[model samples]
Target: MSEALQILQKYWKHDRFRPLQQEIIDSVLSGQDTFALMPTGGGKSICFQIPAMVNKGICLVISPLIALMKDQVANLQKRDIKAIALTGGIKSNEMIDLLDNCQFGNYKFLYLSPERLQSDWILDRIKNLPINLIAIDEAHCVSQWGHDFRPAYLKISGLKDHFPNVPFLALTATATPKAKEEIITELGLHNPKLFQKSFARKNIAYMVFETDDKLFRIEQILKKNPQSSIIYVRNRKSCLEISTQLRYLGFKATFYHGGLSSKEKDKNMLLWMQDEVQVIVATNAFGMGIDKSNVKTVIHIQLPENLENYYQEAGRSGRNGDKAFAVLLTNPSDIAQTENQFINILPDKAFLNSIYIKLCNYFQIAYGEGINEQFSFNLNAFCLKYKFPVLKTYNAMQFLDRQGVITLSQEFSEKITLQFIIPSKEVIRYTSLNPHDEEILLAILRTYPGIYEMQTAFNLPLIAKKSNHPETQIYAVLQKLKEKGIIDYHSRNNDSTLIFNEIREDERTINRVAKYLENQNTLKKEQFKSVLKYIKEDKVCKSKLILNYFGEKTTEDCGICSYCITKKNKKTNTIPLSKEILLIITNEELNSREIQNRINNKSDDVIFAIQQLLENEKIILKPNNKYILKL
Candidate 1:
């Protein structure tokens, strides 16, 4: 067996490598910086993991989402491979201990959030470690012009200054031509080889339906598939409403949004993953790092803001190489709503200034003084309190982020807390009945006085270790205590922070990147508008339209699109409204509405017949309200 295949079987329990995956792994192993563009479910992780496992030193994986980090670490440990993650959710002592393990323990992989890159200690520690390779997941975030840009990702190139010999692997599921170039340039890869898999999914049929009744369309889609499916919406309220409608239709459906507590999110996800729930109605927060293989369909209830987001979210279906469907339901009204959203997103200079002033007022902090201060933002609540337009205000804040004035974290962020629900006296009584938990319970009560007083929010894992209890058992005990009316437990959430990171924003510094980003936005807007063109175009095949948009040069039509099906079975164009029918209607001289009622045919067909008669000079639209024959 080949060496790569040998490692794949021993670790991942697979005999073969996925398409283009082996090529990527081989490039990174050869000490060359690699750029990989694979569609979703193309096995992007194994590209880095296989090479990391074969190399001598630890691989540093820089990711933006904490949930993704946790997932990868868990999967790695399941194979008895040593992996660790450094994130903000843990206690400071725990973070230090984790860092210690990375430095001393024989760990093969270390996953970290991009925000940690700005820390002086993390950089210093990384410089000392014998790092082998650096992998940047979702590498498109490095480009400010990209749809999902992150400021912390800009600092990733600095690692090369410390470890000049380590090759970097940048991987992403979706990126435009512009984003791909920016990623390669920003990373300063040493003659990096780019591996690109085709963005086309042949087995997945794509279609767009224009309808005034999107909710009805969603119901129809669910009824047709009736299997594992995901419905994507734009916000939290819609997620719940659509899920409720699905359940009313007698389908097992669940809802997920950023607003849910971690416990709630986990419970919903577990139910769906276990096949106990047949459908999940969710916002954009639902798909990141999800590995379900049987999602037979993905339906978008509302149009996404851009194509990159739409493509990424829609690409979640058909992972198993089976025939799946992706549908987008919209109407004239939705187009207007989508345009208003984009127009509201303009980075107006004056609006940005007002936002700067509001931040100072909202936080009650002077200029250059809000550093290290964390505040919660409720968009509607803030707008109502300040009498500002909520939609426009959010757009202005995004512009401020681009201007380097503040940082905005859109995910539902909150202070995390882990506390015992029982009082000291009740704990003593319960411990006497359950001696087995006595030692662990006493240790917890002694180590965490703040939990007893309800003074601060704590992390549960830290408390579990301090109490010498299994993490899973501690969670169950906390739940049992809460059910007994001992105390209430609340989970953590993601929040946005406005940091005075750059003390000042000079126009020259901001305009350089802003101009580039604006052009990129223009291109994306044009791309989304073309989907409407495809819907109305009479001659173009749907599959050919999409492939051409992605710059595929093709003359032949795909034999599977709606256009192909319609072309293969053409209908005769016979007019049922004959001259005799028109003559009877003319004799009556009915009004346009009454003429349609007398015809006993579709109003559209009647209208078409009237136009043909007028063109042939057989009839005329009279001055008042009747059609008269030219004779």
Candidate 2:
């Protein structure tokens, strides 16, 4: 216990542990398999880190995201703690060097992706290391029932063969009852001590408002809170539009979305984190690995596809225990819109089968081959070539990825590989004859050391800079050389990469997973139904509804939610709806929709209040369609 505490303070500078963190750590230290379900900001990393730090040998950490693994490794390195992550796209010699470092560098942590476990050579090297503990981050990925299911995570249990005596720790921020059971069974945890913190964030008042104008309601919420806030939309266009509108409305605002470059994301994120921007409008891509404790509000202008995602994103606020708000804004149109966006576009089983066969043929995979083969993919081009619906086909691909038929990465990048197929002396003779290509060939040879011996990844811009030519001309020269068989060259501007983990059985492969694919489509429909039910059942407490969804039954209603407040106000005969409308139009006039937008309550309630005011002669409707106080 003392050692754990000392390590925590030394590396993390934390005086004590959060709730359930220490208990989970103690179980791990006692050589017990441990599973923990904590919230997003609950410090799940420290649970594995402290116990692993207390142990003698290295702790092997398995996670899903390459970016997150690199982020953690960098953070550990900053604190002078020894850690390394075997992330993707490394050369063979680099992999060997990294593995050798893990063997003899006294590194306390070794992080890797679950897909990396499929390689026998890497696993063999890992088996030789003196690993004391195995920690799986985002452990929910192992279960099919989990929201972000990854089939590769199912392979993690195979590690038990290499380290029979070592304990394992599995950590996740969100999981359902079925997911929890499957995660335990899938990981083969031996009588694991389970710890689950309550999903309810008492300080966060979950509220939903059906309004006609979402933008105006955003203004009202921000004006009331007037602190750091996040508004989550569903698309890049909305991100830019909303952020622009907010800035026009006199707020320090920024935007983030998937389309933004890495530099843009970092700059915008820094602005918000440093309080230079008080609000950021973004899509779902902005919040991962963010732990801004004092975020006063998280507003979802679009309906969340599922409660699991909703709960995780909404829980980002009020991490410091101050009062906060989780606001979901929806109109009647949003229900059908959400359904069309998420549910209707889901691919059926037949579509899935067709898509699978097309993908195999597209990649030119032979029957019973192509295991672990990867290709730079362009989704739009593939869909166009096959005459498939882009959204439905993309959804089908996601299903295949989760089912482990293929691993998909949607990172927009350009890949260019080159190697000299002919002898270097022959290439030199040709370059001397063609004076225009001589400088480019010399630049490639000088800048890239071993292109002749290996298929080297190179940048066209760098070669152009070295040769003092335009990038297009450099590419043209390379293409001409490839035409003459001087080099083997390949380049692509790709939207994604597809890596197959199975042989190309075509129909047989699709038949194997067909039932599960249908079941997944059914499951998605049920999830969307649950989300709609949550939205319509406004009479129930928001917090209690969320708790019940996760199978956590709580009898008490959280008094901060919209239902509770409305109930309390009904008993007092003063719903504040009329009061707010009157106050806003007292000095300046606003129409019915504008009044409803100004007040973050039910439009029905707002309309009823406006009617009562009209009947009482307290307010008058002008012929111009505006409401005004009758002085």
Candidate 3:
């Protein structure tokens, strides 16, 4: 066995690689820069991981999502592999320690966000490390034509200049031909080998239903296929509402979104993963690193902004190669809503400038100051204070982040830990004086150890369960304890981190990037139109349409998709008419109207069968407008 194969077996316990995985790995091992285009759930990670294990030095992975990076690092550590992810919001000292570990602690994999590359300190330190290969995940984001474009990715090509000999590997689940070319050109990949897996999933039955009663349709689908499923919504409110509705209908369902605390998210995800919940209704924030193979369905309740997002999300189903369904539920209003929500309301240059200036002022950063400073920003507070629309403001922040003006690290549900500030005797005395808080304090002390000496992870739900108190009541008690100086407590909440990449610039600076914003708006409008087209058009095969959109051509129809099935039903329903037409044409000559009147089928069916019979020579059309059977 090859060394890579042996390592894969040892760690991943896989005997073989999925299609195109080993080929891509071989390309990487040959020290050739390679670009891999594999669909979602195609095991793209193993391609780089196995090669990194077989090589001598660490593999540096640049990814876009902090959650994905953290999940991969945790998984690798479980297998006794040394991997570390340096995401945003890390203290400088912690970052120094992490880099030190990567350089000297035998760490084989280092994952960091693309924005981290902008730091001269980080890049300088990375140059000193014994780097074997550079891997870029979500490589399509580097292209202007791609669905999710990030300007930080354009800086990735600089790594080549620093690491002159190291090969690079770029991986993405969805990319068009233009995006593919741009990825190669922008990343400066040297004569790269390209490996593309077919964008077709035969096991997935792509379906789109236009209905006013989506809830009824969803219930019917769940009743028919009571298996593991994910229902994607557009926002947090819908996620919770849909999940609640599913539960009321007797389904074991859970909800997930960015608004949930980290502990709550983990608990809900664990329940769904363990089959305790049949469905997970969530926003797009869920499912980045989810590896559930038996997810039999992925239903989109709202129209996605583009085909790329839809394909990636729907491809999460049927990973185990079993029959699964990717059902998109939409009404007429959803089409218009999607267009207006995504394309029509894009922040213009002036609005973006206003947001930028407000953001700087919010942080009390003087103009031409605050470069590289990180702050915990409350987005709701900022929006409320400025009377700005929440969604538009958030989109503007994303636009600014894309333009490399600032980096926004979204709220992570990382658990909070706390330690007591006073002695145990002091705590007992205080609790005795306040008997109302005694039960909670005693429960905390009994349920968690090292609370006095170390900052232990505070599990509110678990503590509530143990203390036989409602979670809200427990939270109140914890706050009371914190106020009384009995014990330190940290509550989990959603708070985003903002890192200023450059000094605050004048409004004129915004004009410099106005063209870029306009171009992006145009691209977004085009993408939204494509999505609308996908939803409104019913004649084309869904799978075929998606494949073509992704730059793959296919003449054959997936016989199992919604359109193919409808066509099959139409063909089946006409079979009886063909039989009846032959029966009527035995030896007697008859005209078309006579045959149509005699046959009990629809007139159209009779005409179609007559055309079929004449084409097959089973009957002949006479000059007198009569049909007769041939010997």
Candidate 4:
């Protein structure tokens, strides 16, 4: 067996590599630059990890997501591999100690966000490490043509000058041919070995349904599948609402979003991962660096802003290779909703400048000063003070974040989590006994729908507002209840820290990056056009359309997608039985349309009955090509 195979077996316990994984690993091992354009679940991490293991030195990985960096580091640590990630919230002393550990402690993998490269001290220290391979995940971020372009990623090529001999491997789940080329050019990959797995996922049947009633379609899909699933929404409110609705309809579901405290996220993710919960409804922040092989379906009720995100989110399903589904439920209003959410709210130069100035003033930064200054920015308070629209102001702040003018550490947020320990009757008795606390307890009851059933995160300020009291008073009441063993509760402020990356230059800051920002805006518009076209165009195969979008060409249609199913139904004598019925049909409902619409799904029974009836001549095909049943 090859040494790479040996490493894979030792750590990952896989007998062999997936298609193209070995080749990419071999290319990097041979000291050749490699570009891997694999799908989301195609196991891209092992390509760099195994090579780094085969060699003696630590592998340097630059990623765009802090959550993914931390996740990879934790996974590697669980495997007894010494790895370090320099994500947000690390103090300077802690960063120095981590760097020292990497320099002398023989760590195998070091993952850091590309934004960290802006620190000269970090770059200088990293240049001295015994780096063997450079892995750039999310390589599309380096290309301005890419859907998620980050300006800091462009600075990664400078490392090439530092580590002249170390080979580079770039990986991205979704990238266009143009973006691929730009990634290669921007990173200065020299005669890179390219390995691209086909964008087609044969086991996944992509389905798109045009329905005004999305919740009905979601219910229908879940009832048919009834397995582990993820429902992606565009907003946090929708996540909670959908999860509650699914639970009301008798499905075990939980909600996750960025606003959830770390403990809440971990608890909810664990419940879903362990199959204690059958479904997890969440926003886009839920699925990075987490893989569950048994997820049978991924439902997107809201049309994603772009197809790249949709493909990645939908690809989370069916990883176990049994037949799975990727369903997209869209209504006519979704287009306008998408545009207004993503495009119309996009910040222009004027908005960007105004927002930047407002931020500097909000933090009390002096003109031409405030370089390297950081502040704990309460987004709600800032928006309220300025009377700026929340979403638009947040978008502008994100624009500034992307342009490197400010570093917004949104990951550092907190929320109140609580649940009633006593039964409803006991809680009511306690509330009556404690009349002074009754108002706050009642406010909690009115604010949270399932406080007695399960623990969940809540908006503390909102609860306070509901109780017509100060937030401190609400916190004190919850604490008193906890002490009395009436309820379990905790609360923390939800504040995002903002670090000013550049000196306070009001208008020039926005002007300096106006062209780049405008170009990105245009790219977003173009991306939405493709998204709209893909959902609206039912003539082309959905799988083929997605495949072609990533520059892969194939002549044959995937015969399992929604388009293929619809095309098959167009032929003669194809009974329009619901997929729910195709799975199982009971004896009593064999000839009943109403029951057939809600039949049990057991393949063998249905197939066996068909064979028995055909052989006994109880069923016959007539000359008109209709199946006639003679009892």
The model with the greatest TM-score is: 4
Model 1 clash pairs are 412-494, 413-493, 413-494, 413-495, 414-493
lDDT of 4 by residue, 251-299 (tens): 9999899978789899999999999999999999999987899999999
Measured against the true structure, the TM-scores of the candidates, in listed sequence, are 0.74, 0.80, 0.79, 0.83
Q: Model 3 Cα displacement at 276 (Å)? A: 1.4
Identify the runs in model 1 with alpha carbons over 4 angstroms from their true place. 89-94, 398-524, 534-538, 569-631
**Regions more than 4 Å wrong, model 3:** 412-493, 572-631
Regarding TM-score, does 2 or 4 come out ahead? 4
User: Which residue pairs come into collision in candidate 2?
Assistant: none
Show where candidate 4 strays beyond 4 Å: 411-490, 572-631
After best superposition, candidate 2 residue 334: deviation in angstroms? 1.1
Q: For candidate 3, write residues 419-468 as lDDT tens digits.
A: 78999889888888988877877888997666786556565656666677
Query: What is candidate 1's CA lDDT for residue 267?
Result: 96
For each candidate, the alpha-carbon lDDT, in order, equals 0.73, 0.85, 0.85, 0.84
Q: How does candidate 2 score on lDDT?
A: 0.85
Sort the candidates on lDDT, descending order. Answer: 2, 3, 4, 1
- Report residue 572 deviation for candidate 3 (angstroms): 5.9
Per-residue lDDT over 394-420 for candidate 2, one digit per residue giving the tens place of the 0 to 100 score: 889988876778888866333576889
Model 1 poorest ten-residue lDDT run: 501-510
